[model samples]
Target: MSHHDEEIDAAGRADEFLQVFKKGAEFTQDLLKENERLRFRVVQLEETLKEKGHDTVDESPDAIELKKKIEVLEQEKEEILGQIKVVEEENQNFANRYIEIEEENNMLANLYIASYQLHSTLDFKEVLQIILEIVINLIGAEEFGVLLLDEKTNRLEPVASEGLVTSELPSVAVGEGIIGEAVHSGENYFIDSMEGYERDFEKPIVCIPLKIKEHVIGVIAIYKLFTQKDEFTNVDYELFTLLAGHAATAVFSSRMYSDSERKLSTIQGFIDLLTK
Candidate 1:
């Protein structure tokens, strides 16, 4: 009975050892499969990094900040271009204003010179000469005449003539020709082209009336302008106004002074004779 029991026990122990060995072999096979799967996943991540053109997978914060700075710089460039255009326009305006101011100063200087020369002398003959000089030199006139109204007939007669070969000017009443019309109206009349007054004179340019207060004393007739002068500007009209108001009065004062001196000399001689 003891031998049979011992044999049965040895057989059961052998069966249990076989079962434990089988389970351990199965666990080792599963661990090998999981290691292969992890290696495949690592290879896939490396390929994705290559396709995106990056050594690492994630983008840093500094790279995003640099992109924003580039956009801001492009916007600033557009603003600077607009400012440059505005500065160019302002420079052009300043240049135009400078030219206008220079022209005004030159006109003022010319007026002052004319005024000083007209009042420098009291002699009647010298005054007539001065008037001719002003027309020929200062006014840049080629042909001109000084016509005075005769008190007896109330007709305009040329007292002085320049750049013309005629012996005497044509007779003109106070309201007849262009010169006479200005004398009667006491205002300056301007003709733009030679075609306007071609019948009266070859090229009558302007006629300025000489007035002393309310009365017109004479007229200054300008037949033709200088070759360089194309037309009369506003500066020329201002000069005409100055001459009309001042020149006539200057001539009248000189004549009155001369007549008074002659009368005084005659009375003094008579008194000396009576005393002797």
Candidate 2:
């Protein structure tokens, strides 16, 4: 079933469980009050018998019957309490499961919103900035760069970067390093352990290649992550996969549009010069 459907189903079950718990608690409270009333009645009967000169109050038939009834009610109360404990544990488990499902739903919603914003603009700089925001806010990347492949030089050059010197970033040839290998093979590369990870300009901690079909267009190299982010989650991997295709298309399309605009401006300028 879908996660949304599962969440709804869980919510229904939790509501039903809560109703049962409420009823059980009320019944237990009633039993306690009844037991207390019966004990007070027994005490009153013993005092009356003593004043009437009856030395053996325990032997009185009314007293014996009332004591028996109180014992039975006490046993029932204990059993109900045990049942309530079991129900409480089950309810706690359900609550924990519900929280997990809710978190997953929230992550999915965030992914949808990020994907929509990525395609909402045709500006090349805006596309890159959107990607940077996704990585920093969503993936918790602290230092990263968006590198596009330079066809003329057969190298990947930095188009945008965060938490690092953009001008100082070196261009990497395809298949030369970790980022290069990801682009060359069109597969993601990441370290399994992020414990005590240090920054390496040449070797990033994680590399995600941006691909259009079978062709790799660029790479996202993450050198460091935020200190608070100890490890990557399943949603982080999903974001990387989404960026691989969507980010590539956005960047490529925006770059093409930018180039066309420049060409159109140049042609219009030439025509105006000829007319003058």
The best candidate by lDDT is: 2
lDDT of 2 by residue, 1-276 (tens): 999999999999999999999999999999999999999999999898787756455778888889899999999999999999999999999999999999899988998888898899999999999999999999999999999999898899998999998877889999988888888999999887877777887888889999999799999999998989988889899999999989999999999999999999999999999999
Clashing pairs in 1: none
Candidate 2 Cα RMSD after full superposition onto the native fold (Å) = 33.1
Q: Which stretches in model 1 have alpha-carbon errors above 4 Å?
A: 1-74, 165-167, 195-203, 271-276
Model 2, C-alpha of 227: deviation from truth (Å): 2.5
The per-model lDDT (C-alpha) reads 0.78, 0.92
Name the regions of candidate 2 deviating beyond 4 angstroms: 1-79, 266-276
Number of backbone clashes in candidate 1:
0
Number of clashes recorded per candidate:
0, 0
